[model samples]
Target: MATLVAIGYPDETTATAASLEARRLAKDLIIQPDAIATIIRDREGKFHVTTTHHPVGAGATWGMFWGFLFGLLFFVPFFGMAVGAGMGALMGKMTKGAINKEFQDQVRDLVKPGTSALFLVIERSTPDKAVEAMSQFGGTVLKSSLSKETEAELQEALHGEKSAAEV
Candidate 1:
């Protein structure tokens, strides 16, 4: 079983710091995390998301491959390569290149404006110690459970959104 833990903070700075702290702790073997993501709704009403697991150069790689194929199709290898590389780079930037967009959107909708939330998918944790380490940030605990589905249900309940059954 895994636990989905979400913590709400007053601002992005705290949330970001808390996430960094969590990563540092994870490296120390204090907490084992399967995944972690942060969502911040800025003062401008725009949302920003950060995750640790995004490929740094996936765009170029995919672009190169596609470019080669297209070049072969059009009989213009160099031209195809250039176009593919450009298009691939653009696509990568547009996509932020990786991570689950659906999950990101779901989290974006869950938090209020001018606030940030830290979402951690934890495999194992020393509950008391982990809580103590994160206590200084002082966030509203949104959800915690050994089941992702149950956690999702709690989130829906908190937001007064429809449950899966009703949907």
Candidate 2:
């Protein structure tokens, strides 16, 4: 089962930077993430989401390929490609992509306007190492599926607290 974690940051830039760091941490085996999304609440209170994956583009590309092959039979390759790409893009937009909009909106409400949040779908991870990696870019935990104790420990980790000595 994948756990969702949303960490709120001061700004869009910081959230984006932290998302990149989290990706790097995943690559380093510090954290295992199924998906990572960045949500930015603009100055006007509008929310926008940024993702590393491009599902629409992928869908269009595949549609174009299939369309071209089918069009060859009808001698209307360009027309088929155009129609297929459009349809595919529409489908991609309508379908549920990687990011969960409901969860995103919920997290968005948790963050203040002009702030940003990093939403992650985690499969599993080494908590200590992942927390350490995120400590440098301290953020407030907006929401997470982690247990209360683990979440509190993560908060402490973000504050750079190492055991009782730091406190």
Candidate 3:
């Protein structure tokens, strides 16, 4: 699952240093960096944070496209390319692009003033060390499950909006 560890600081330099330290500790404890946060400096010199996710391969998108193509081919009279594209897209999605994209989105949404958040993808059993290591930077904890829950929330939100419109 994805856990967002947020660190807030009064100044940009201190926050940046703390973020680096947190990163180092996370690395030392073998945390897989799913995403990264950035330090923002406002005109008042107060440090703020916002995170953006590094890009991963666009395999999942490719897969979705291929799925549509293959479904079309299978249903259509004679389109062999559809099936091949769909299969290729599925393979690409499974090879890290999908997970990485998910990670990036999670990291990007939470960055704001006075907070630098690191999004870490961890196994259920291995989160303790990462949590401990990252805490040294002194930030609030904003942990969210990185599984179907996030996707479920998205679905729920969409459905809610649609339902509201219906009313």
Candidate 4:
């Protein structure tokens, strides 16, 4: 059940500012609430909102691999320690390699101009405050949500039953 709510702000900074203002106005749709939402500001200065469902620990599963290698290296002795150290070094290099590649891609984007997408996990009740805050930045609010009928239709499709795609 995804609801698309639009909050308009004049610029990114203003939108960011409204996060503070929202406290006085709405107080519920606070940015960085629970560290659940990710704010992706693209080069065009548009805000993209993504709710992190399965956040892999530290650039994905690499965290666990590195952790295990260290555990083995520390807890084990002799050949085990040697093995741990070797594996640790290999895993560390591998982790660094992946991070570097990702950073390179990000670096290519560089410091983009204007405001990027400011993400927020808005509940059903705080729609008004979200709208108000976004508008403070001189932006427009466009609430996008699926109606009950639409939801039913989507559910039907999901169940592989019937759909309106025919007509």
Best by TM-score: 1
Model 3 root mean square deviation, Cα atoms: 14.9
- The RMSD of every model to the true structure, in order and in angstroms, is 14.7, 15.7, 14.9, 15.6
* Global lDDT scores for all candidate models: 0.53, 0.52, 0.40, 0.37
> Which residue pairs collide, candidate 1?
none
Compose the digit string of candidate 4's lDDT tens values, residues 1-167. 22334343434455455444544443343432322322334456443443323323222222233233223322212222222333344444433442234332342243244443232334344556555555646644444344444433332322223334423
Clashes (backbone N, CA, C under 3 Å), per candidate, total 0, 0, 4, 15
> What shift in Å separates residue 13 of candidate 4 from its native position after superposition?
1.4
lDDT of 2 by residue, 47-92 (tens): 6666553233323432232233223212323432344434443334
Q: Is candidate 1 or candidate 2 better by lDDT?
A: 1
Which parts of model 4 have CA positions greater than 4 angstroms off? Answer: 8-10, 23-32, 35-113, 146-167
Writing each residue's lDDT as its tens digit, candidate 3 over 1-167 gives 43434344443444566556545654654553324444444545343433323322322222233233223312212223233343354334433333344433443343334444333444333566666765666654545443454333222321222222133
Candidate 4, poorest ten consecutive residues by summed lDDT? 73-82
lDDT of 2 at 131: 54
Point out the higher-scoring one by TM-score: 1 or 4. 1
Candidate 1 local accuracy as lDDT? Answer: 0.53
Ranking 1 against 3 by lDDT, winner: 1
